[model samples]
Target: MAGMLNIGVSGLNAAQAQLNTTSHNITNAGTVGYHRQTVGQAARPPLFTGAGFFGQGTDVTSVTRSYNQFLENQVLQADNRRAQYGAYSAQIGQINNLLADSTTGLSPALANFFAGVQEVASNPTSVAARQSLISNGQALASRFQSLNTRLEEVRQGVEGGIVQTVESINTYAKAIAEMNQRIVVAQAGGAGAPANDLLDQRDQLLAELNKLVQITVVDETDSGKANGAVSVFIGSGQPLVLRGTVSQFQVIPSAADPQRGAISLTAPGGNTIEIAESLLSGGELGGLLEFRLVSLDAAQNELGLIALGITETFNAQHKLGVDLEGVLGKDFFKPIAPTVVPAVAGVSTSITDVSEVRAKDYRVLVSGGSVRLFAGDEELASLALAPAPAWPATLTGGGIAVSLPGAASIPADGLLIQPTRNAARNIAVGISDPREIAAGGPVSVTSPLTNQGTGKVANIDIRDIAGMDGSGDGVPDFSAFALGFDGTGPALTVPAGFTIERLKMDAATGEWVTDGSYPSGGSSTTYTPSADSSGVQFRVTGPGGYTFDFRFSGTPESGDAFSFGPSVAGVADNRNAVALGALQTTKVLGADASGRPTATFQSLYAQTVTTVGNKTREVQVNEAAQESLLDQATSARDSVSGVNLDEEAANLVRYQLAYQASARVMTVAQRLFDELISIGR
Candidate 1:
């Protein structure tokens, strides 16, 4: 009977314990970093029978947490990926907003300024319009200056975030290492288990670490400890946070520039770890850095490009035009300096006030139709004449040069008089009527040469010389291009195209196939306009220069033309030449106003305004989409692991009921034992 009672008591105790375990699991179900627990039971012992023994009672063996190591690892990995993109995307979205702001953006100011320029161009003599244009230009400059300052501020913010992240990672690593030490100690002491709570704490830390950087964990054994230690490292067993007595990882700032505040991890052997952000794939810090540096850098470069294109184009136009009467020697647009600048033309060095400097010091040169820029005394006409389809034929300068339609006398009355050093500066040559120029024959233009004695004959030529018909396949021909000569030199011989030597005649081919180099007496020949047919002749210019004479063996074909490129050493300026002819004096405002610069200026301004508006729209749409996606992903992740107060409350009540029942069972057992003892006495 006593044994039977003992068996019933054991069963009650085991049942009560199981109920407590279940309650605990339910209570912490809503808690972060909690695992479900279960109570395991087994038969205490078997009575020895002749053949076999039967179980007498049940005993609680162990309470194991219901956990899957592989599943937990999967969750951690996924968290790292999500965190990286989450942080980076959030930050970038903010920057996009800042840049896309209409009031603060540079687009509006630029549009306003260009519109003012159009107004001025429409009425060149209007001082009001000119002053307005200047004001608008100043506003545009201010916009660029402010935007650059803001970008620097954003860069500083990113650096601050990087430093904070590194510090956080170190803190977590130390906590994890401490937990490992405690676990080892407990296991060695023959404790029930290596403190499940402590293990959970360590796991929580690792989850946080994944957001900052990627990591891998391995089970390791300590020679003196009962339970093997856990070793933690980055990606490939590069021990970072060691699981000895204490955990430590090295974090250092970039050596190149401390101000940049970039951080990196180091190994015990003092080897620096190179972390490729893109390869990291799922680390918050890496993602943030990549977005801040790479993505932002690209955006800044693109902004600079647009700014550069506009600056170069506008400055080219400004270089050609005449400013206010007193500002003859000044450049309207400034040239930007080379430095860490936000936009093109942002750090330009232009003389805003010519009065601060002397006119002669300005030494400005406007482009003339006949003038060609040369690096040295060498002729580049042949290469210069070659067609470049991508090159815009319109002059960069906004100014348009206008000559009288016919060879008529230009009225001297009320002529704008200004002294300029620019080679392309407008000059009223000999007095001629604007309406008397004829279509045929050369018209005598009498513009006063800057230095007639110095051979500076600035004139406009509109002929085949301006077009790239010689070499380039269909480039627009400008008539105002010009070339300079020393007068004592050999007449120029411009080649249609350059020639490169290919294969030479081989020994097997006795015929003159491309093979052997020029023999001791071997000669090279070039073609020129023939006296007879347009066909070319390979003529030897010098005596004894020709080892043999040659000719085009095949008969003539339609559309075939004789072309020449290389020249004999004796032919001066033939080595390479630049054909300078006419300068196309088209206005920047519009194509219809081919010679009217004022109209062209208006057209350019309109294009800039349109482009800015379009960019604004694109940025807004992209940002909105990014926000929506982030919200949906967050909601889905939360449903799986989010803490809930109601669930915890329900678990608390259930555990209280089990505790009450266990106490009642113990009370009843005590009463029964007291009664039995009384009867025996």
Candidate 2:
């Protein structure tokens, strides 16, 4: 009877414990990260009987919380990737909006500016038309400045976000460290119960941290640590948390860019090592760094390319003509100068002219012997590193004059120099005067009085205009042609460096006629030609850089002579404007460092717009995928660990009934003992 009573008591105690656990689960059902608790039960040692061992009532063993390591880790990864793409999509959307807008976009401004060019070309002597063209040019420059300024604003916002994210990450790291300390304490002193609640909270904090930066975790329990602590590392195995200790990081400006962000972690020895941006991935921090390093930088330089190309091409053509005042046309637009960015700290750079700057970014690598240049991964040139008398010594290549200190050593990855990053910032009009417009070509072509033949020369126009080489040699190299036709052809003295090419025109597309003209259809008659007799195209090649083209269509007499000379000062010729307007459709943007044409300006800009739009859409799709993954992970975790109120309620009723039944058995045993005592009296 005593044994029976003891058995019932044991069962009652087990049932009471299970009931308490059920109540706890029910009350915390809405709590995040709360795992359902279960009271484990096992039958006590069987009582020895004559027949055989019989089972004793059950006793509670241990309370365990359900968990799955794999599911939780998956959730963390999903959150990380979702954050990265979300940030990237949000940031890149601004570029798409700016470039695709009809009003503020570059396309309309480019078209309007060219329209003004055509108007001036149609009426070169009209002051009103010239002034309108200058206004349009100014407007175009203003648009460039606005777009560049807005992009800088986005970069600044990214920097600010970095600061905030770093702080948040540090805060979470400290909280996690604190939780680890409590967990170590709760797990101390032999066969101790796990601090399941503390672990849950720590996991929650870890998920939050993953959103800011990707991290890898090492649970010491799996690695033979006594305290079962967790260690967290980020970005190429830099430890943020080691056991209970937390390390802080900082964001600093890069040597190559003052406003650029470089993440650095303070080591245990108090030294700081910079983390390469690429090594860090899978969160908002990764997204911001990637966008700034690649897309944003590229967009800004490309925008500058437009500014630099227009300024350089227009100014070069403008200088080749005479204005209404009969003076040589000076710069109608301010030139963009080269910019040198130092890869090493304390080094500097500069440029000489806009024409010297290309649209491509140059990577300057230093060696023991000399400095090397690279466009992306391709090496373009190298210059012997020399000592500087002037602060930044000049090394010219890749269409740029890069000024670097002769004494500075290049960093391992090299200096990234972008001469056009700020090209659009100060793109304002340099010429405001209507009379300053260069409407006439600098050279005149006319027939000499001595020509007795029926031979006639077509009107000559300048192509391939080069800036005055500061050699006082922009003068026309043409004199009266000693014209005549022997049985062979007409001959004249051709100077060196003078070029001849056929013209190619597309009237339907309105592209300017190219200088690649065809060979003359008619063969030379009784004349000695300077060029091939079969090819009636004769060109006076000059030793100077002066070049212009014309064609002859008639038979030349032996004594026929012609003269091509410098502008007879003050001719109201709109010939230069006509050629200048042809620049409206010129392919000037996509050029190699050697000045080879690739794509037109319109195509390049369109490509950029398409890239940003595509990137935005890609991020959106990726974010959605990541989000779906997160949902799946969360569901898997919840299936095993989440609290269920209905199950808990059922457990409550079952445990209540078990406690009552055990109490009733003890009462019955007491009643039997009382009856025996009464009968004995």
Candidate 3:
């Protein structure tokens, strides 16, 4: 009877515990990160019987939380991927809109400015038209400046975003560390009951942390405290947390760029180490860094290329013309001195030629006293990095200049050098006066009417020569001389383009000027015409060796004369203006290191727009797909671990019935004991 009563009491206790667990599950069904609790039962030691062993009573064993490690890990990974793409897609969309918009973008400004150039070419003497050209040029410069400002604003915003993300990650890391401490204390004894709810809370914190920065989690149960816990790491095994001890991560303003924030880790000895930007990936911070480093940097550099190409090429052409002031045309566009910024981690770079600059950030890897350059994975150049000791090192041909300082300066992972990164913002108009516009070529050439021949001279240009000077008076020199090709007198066998035929000279100053007659006994010089000259050349030695050419097309008499004249001051000369307008079709934007032409300005700008648009489109599609995957992963995890209220409700009813049956059993045992007692009495 006593044994019967004890068995009934154990059954009652088990039923009561089951009811309590079911009630707890149903009440916390909607709780975030909650896992359902389950109770396990085992039969106590069975009493020995003659026939077979009979169970003494049912005893409750461990209560476990419904969880799956693989399913939970799947959820975490999916969340990280989705967050990274979503973040990147959100930020890159701004640049896409900026470059593609016709109203405020670079296309309209380029078109209107070129149109202004053509207008001036049509009416070279019109002050009103020149003024319009200046206005259009100013508008274009303003547009470049404005676009640069907007991009900087975007970068600053990204910097702020980075700081915020690091702070959140730090908060999560600390909280997780605290939870680890609590869990270790709760489960001190081996085989002690697990703090399931506390584990859920810690896991929830980890899920949130991974969204800001992707991390590698190590189960610390065997390592940290012999209790169930995890350690977290990020970016190539940089430890973030070690059980109850956490390493602090922080964002500090970059020394190279004050507007940017650098990520760092704080070691236990109060030492802060800088984290390389390349090591980070797979979360919101990763996405922002990608935008700042790659997308934003490339766009700014591409914009700079247009500004630079126009600056160098247009100014080169502009200098070939004469201004309305009867003087040489100065630079119409101010030069943006190539930025040679040194990295905080010990590397420096500068652009050697604006025409050859590409929209890419190059990496400078230094190792074994030699350096290698890479645009991503493609190796652009590699050379010995030993100190030049004489000249500035021209790395990777003459396109980029690099410097490696002392022995310990180079980082093991190298550095990134972005030369044209800030070009557009600093560009502005160099010449503001409309009268300074060069609209006329510096020299003129023609044929004399006395020459009864089809021979012709065309397109004479004054090429640059050191120490060359014009007359002190503001008026251009208009000396007239003739290319007298005496075909009968001397049957001179000479190079057709440059010949030592009978020479002539005529100048106000008779010192080495062309006068159509050689000195009495002086040695006559040769003539070297330009390449397009058909069969004749007229060369002069003075003024750094000026040369002109006549296309000796048909038969010439004994003395066929071609005439030369200096340009008139402030006249309607549109040769230079027309050349400037023709630059619209010139392949001046893209030039490789060896001076090979690639793309024009129009095509390069279009490529930039297309690249940004494609990246945005790709991210949008991938984000949508990742979101769907994340949702599916969450559902799968929830099915096994998540609590269901309906099931718990049915469990409550079943446990109550078991409890009633156990109470009846106890009552029957008491009645049997009472009957036995009565019979004994």
Best by lDDT: 3
Candidate 2 lowest-lDDT run of ten: 519-528
Error of 1 at 52 (Å): 5.5
Is candidate 1 or 2 superior in lDDT? Answer: 2
Cα RMSD to native, each candidate?
A: 19.1, 4.9, 7.1
TM per candidate comes to: 0.54, 0.87, 0.84
Error of model 1, residue 529, in angstroms: 22
Name every residue pair that clashes in candidate 3.
Answer: 504-515, 504-516, 504-517, 505-514, 505-515, 505-516, 505-517, 506-514, 506-515
Give the whole-model CA lDDT for all candidates, comma-separated. 0.43, 0.74, 0.75
Per-residue alpha-carbon lDDT of model 3 for 1-681, expressed as tens digits?
Answer: 988999999999999999988988998898888888998899999998898987788999977899999999888888888888888898889989998999989999999999999999999999999999999988999998898888888877888899899999989999999998888878775365888889989989999999988899998756444477789999999999998888988898664444468899997668898888888898898888887877887888888878878877788788777888666677888876555334454345555665566666556676666677765566777766455333334466335666655434545556656556667887778887888899887676666678775556555544442223356554455354445554543231222233332333333222223435432212233222332235543333233344432224345555666655566678888888998998887776566555666777788889899999998999899889888988999899888988878888899999999999999999999999999999999
Best by the TM-score measure? 2
RMSD of 3: 7.1
Candidate 3 lDDT: 0.75
Provide the lowest-lDDT 10-residue window in model 1: 574-583
Candidate 3 TM-score, true structure as reference: 0.84
What tens digits encode model 1's per-residue C-alpha lDDT throughout 1-681? 455556666777776777676666666766677665667889888788888876577788877665567567666665666666666666666556656677876658756866665555455455565566556655665665565556556666677776787778778777777777887777667463656656666777777887787788777754654363576776444565666633334435533222345455565556666443344444767766776655454444334333333343444334222223211112233543222111222112222211111111111112232212121222111112233322222211212221211111112111111111111111111112211111111111222333122221112221211222224432212122111111222111212231211123334322234323322112222222122133322211222111111233222222222322111111111000011001111222222222322322223333434443444344345445544554555444444433344654565566456556545656676788888899999
Sorting all predicted structures by lDDT, with the top scorer first, yields 3, 2, 1
